[model samples]
Target: MTSPRMIQIASGKGGVGKTWLSVTLAEALAAMHRDVLLFDGDLGLANVDVHLGLVPTLDLGSVIAGRARIEEAITTYEIPSVSGAAGGVKFDVLAGKSGSGVLSALTRTEIAGIARALSRLSERYAHVVIDLAAGLDQSVMALCTPDSTTLVVVTDEPTSLTDAYAFIKLLTLQDAEADIRVIVNFANDREHAWRTHAALTNACKTFLGIAPPLAGFVPRDNLVRDAIRRQTPILFRHPQAKASEAVRKLARDLLVPLPKSTPGPVLRRGA
Candidate 1:
């Protein structure tokens, strides 16, 4: 039997480079010879294509609207390998819909279908990275219902901090048993990043009574802004940037083997 691939990238607040990190991480894993799929689960502000600077030929909106097939909506892009000296394989990006059609496509039944479909895809691919919305919602639940790894991105700013705490609060209520991985983005340095991670982890322990694991941090680099202005991802535009370097290290950290893959207990899905 094959395992399902689901990892969600999100933040408590907006503009903390959640989407950016998700895209780059997916690319990094692909470089390591892992098949990956980056799904833009954010309906309110779907822009994975913008980060890659490629206008998706089709999006989930079209697929749900019967205008496109799941396969037809997938766009393939090249991501550099971790070796830096070698090239990486391609990743299929599933962009989300922008209009009212987003709600119409994912009924309770459709979500179930999506879960099954993603598993089949995961069997063939190595990693499937999902970019979820900022907060809890219909789409977020549907996509995250299958998540095995979760990365919560945040910044040192007050709003981001408060939002990160609120996000974990909602997760506790929804998926209390889920593994929460925290990522602090746009930090001044390691110290600032640790503070943000510590704050969130401490809150999870205090409120939810569980200490969340710190995934890692991404440094604040002006090159990210410049890359965005150029309509390209920093990983591709400025591979040497601090943010890029951080993500590459993170890619190996996540992809590299840990103690072992003890099967996390299974939760049977009901019809």
Candidate 2:
């Protein structure tokens, strides 16, 4: 069996719609008939459950504390059919404990154990999308592996671009061959999106000598805020929304098969 394709959605700062993208992206992949597991890697302030309106009894914290097995902590989410589509989409989620700094305080070895567990869990799914916490922190870095496709979410704001550059630079320093890509969120238009991507790419090419391609861009839409407010995935609530269509296109683009050979996990150091 082909190993699951690991995808890590990351960002330099908060409030860039990283979590929203993660949730909708997972749903989009599921809509495409791929079995996906959306793991909330944001250990400290996890809210994937909140975004999806899920009240999971067991979470990653339970698994980490040995109170529950990793598989037992998974909560399945289903989206019923809308717009005459056939069977609706379904995906699994491994939620994180919110308002508790305990998981964030885990040592490197403990993080490694979680990583190994995720590696084992990957065997049963076609894709595993990890929503990493914002900023350059130990928890975020430890979960990033060289084999995963890292999508750095950025906007046109100056701080967003600067922090994203710092993140890509640091990740490159850690793994020179890291598969880094960019996603421009809240873009005003296609021109604006390309401009944002070029700015970040120019900075990386000039300073880091590497230009990560733009995987895709999500346009700014008021409906997106509405979906989030309702605690429903935009793709299901507003399938025809511009942002939803963009994410669906992204899912189709990423559906291209990866290489046959799989690499062993290479977890990065927190420090």
Q: Score each candidate by Cα lDDT.
A: 0.72, 0.86
Candidate 1 residue-wise lDDT, 1-271, digit = tens: 1333567787767788888888888876776677889988776677788777677778877776789777788888865433443244678898876444444346756765765666666666778898887765555666666347777888778788778787777776778766677788878887777777788767777877876666677888899888777655567668889988888877776754444333222212220
Candidate 1's C-alpha runs over 4 A off are 1-4, 79-89, 98-112, 260-271
Best by TM-score: 2
TM-score per prediction, in order, is 0.84, 0.91
> Across residues 31-143, which tens digit of lDDT does each residue of candidate 2 receive?
88899999999988899999988999999999988999999999998875544453467999999997687898998788877888998998899899999999898788888
Candidate 2 Cα RMSD after full superposition onto the native fold (Å): 6.0
